[model samples]
Target: MESMLIEKSVQGDVESFEKLIVKYNRYVYNIAFRMMGNEEDAKDMSQETLIKAFKAIGQFKMESNFSTWLYRITINVCKDELRKRKETVLSYDAPLNEDEVTLKDTLKDETYNPLLIYEKLELRSSIENALNQLSEDSKSVVILKDIMGYSYEEIGAILEIPIGTVRSRLNRSRTTLKNILQIQLSEN
Candidate 1:
């Protein structure tokens, strides 16, 4: 069913392309969210990604799965958006200085228990914090390889870099993340 839709869409069937967009919208949105962080920006990025994908459908190589190619395009669109957003530092990095510290101490909510703390640290939030601390190139490699489950070769193809560069970036991102986590823990 999807392959048929892809074929039709690639052939310039607007309805088929619209259906394909409907089918993959959530997947693309989630990827955008992971890459962008903010909901508004993710929505804009996802919309722009779909528009770009539709525009370039004729040029898509059928040698790869449609979703794979779409995902690559989505990531590229996301990278462009990130670049436009300028340099955003990880919120975790700028440790709460005196005013923030006082506010945190005074307005502490009792909602976050150890279990909740562990759960938050287990997935998206913690990983995002770590990734946000990385250089954009390193962040892109790690997000593609680790979060999005792209293989090194696929990432290389998507980024137009060698697999060795992808692997090296992943290693450096991992090391940076480990160091950041260690620092956070020791400070706590």
Candidate 2:
């Protein structure tokens, strides 16, 4: 079905292109949101990514899955946006603060204690802060592999790096994150 959509889209079928956008919009937006660490920028980046994909559909080779191709585009769009903004650190807490629903509500545990929830939230905040401290390259690798659960090869393809490089960067990122977390805990 995806292949059919891609074929039609490549043939200049507007409806087919729209269908592809509808199918992958959320995935693209999530990647942008995670990379940008804000909703508005994420939405803009996602829209730009889809527009680029639509325009360049003909150039897309069938060697990769459409989703992977889309991911590559999304990453590039984000990198460009980041460069334009000249911003390195991002606040992952922005979206959470704007949401009406609480994490406890989402967890939906009958035995959920407010104190425990507070502790969890604190830990999550610490983790996000640590993540923001990483360099863009390390942060992207960590988010793709650890947060988004992409395979090393898939991340390699997305980031245009070797699989070994992906593994090594991920290891270093994880170590940095762990150290940051430890320091945060000890300080608390």
Candidate 3:
């Protein structure tokens, strides 16, 4: 079914492309948010990714995973924006107007205890702060692998790097994140 859509989309069918947008826009937005650290930038980057995808749909290889290709476009867009802007670290406690629950929420346990909740929120903030400290290369690897659950092979494809490089980046990023979190904990 999706192959048919991809085929039509490649043939310059607007409707088919719109269908593809409906299917993958949220994934693109999630990647954008992880990369950009704010809803507004994520929204804008997601739109830009879709536009780029639409323009390049004809060049998409049918044998490849469509989601991976879309993710690649999204990552590239975010990387470009991050490069131009240099720095942006937004708070996670900001208002959420939509009903879409993110991966962060899913990983968290549903706890009613106030102290546990507070600690969890604080830890989350520290982790995000740690993530922000990582270089773009490491941050993308960690986000794609740990947060987004992309396999190493898939991450390599999405980031257009070798799988070995992806593994090393993820390993190094994880170690750095752990060290950062440890220091934060010691300070508190």
User: Whose TM-score is greatest here?
Assistant: 3
Tens digits of per-residue lDDT for model 1 on 15-118? 99988778679878988877777789889999999988988988887777777788788888988877887776433234433222222243366343322444
lDDT of 3 at 1: 86
In terms of lDDT, model 2 sits at 0.78
Q: How much RMSD separates candidate 2 from the native structure?
A: 8.7
Candidate 1 residue runs with Cα over 4 Å from true position: 1-3, 10-12, 89-124
**Candidates' lDDT values, in order?**
0.71, 0.78, 0.78
Between which residue pairs do clashes occur in model 3? none
Model 2 Cα lDDT, one tens digit per residue, 26-68 = 8899888877877898899999999999989999888877888
After superposition of all CA atoms, the RMSD between model 1 and the true structure is 6.8
Which should have the higher TM-score, number 2 or number 3?
A: 3
Q: Write the per-residue lDDT of candidate 3 for residues 39-150, one digit (tens) a residue.
A: 9998999999998898898899988899999999998888888888777432232322334443334445655442344478788888887787666677788899888898
| Per-prediction CA RMSD (Å) | 6.8, 8.7, 9.6
**What TM-score would candidate 2 get against the native?**
0.77
What are the clash counts of all predictions, listed in order?
A: 0, 0, 0
Worst 10 residues of 2 by lDDT: 90-99
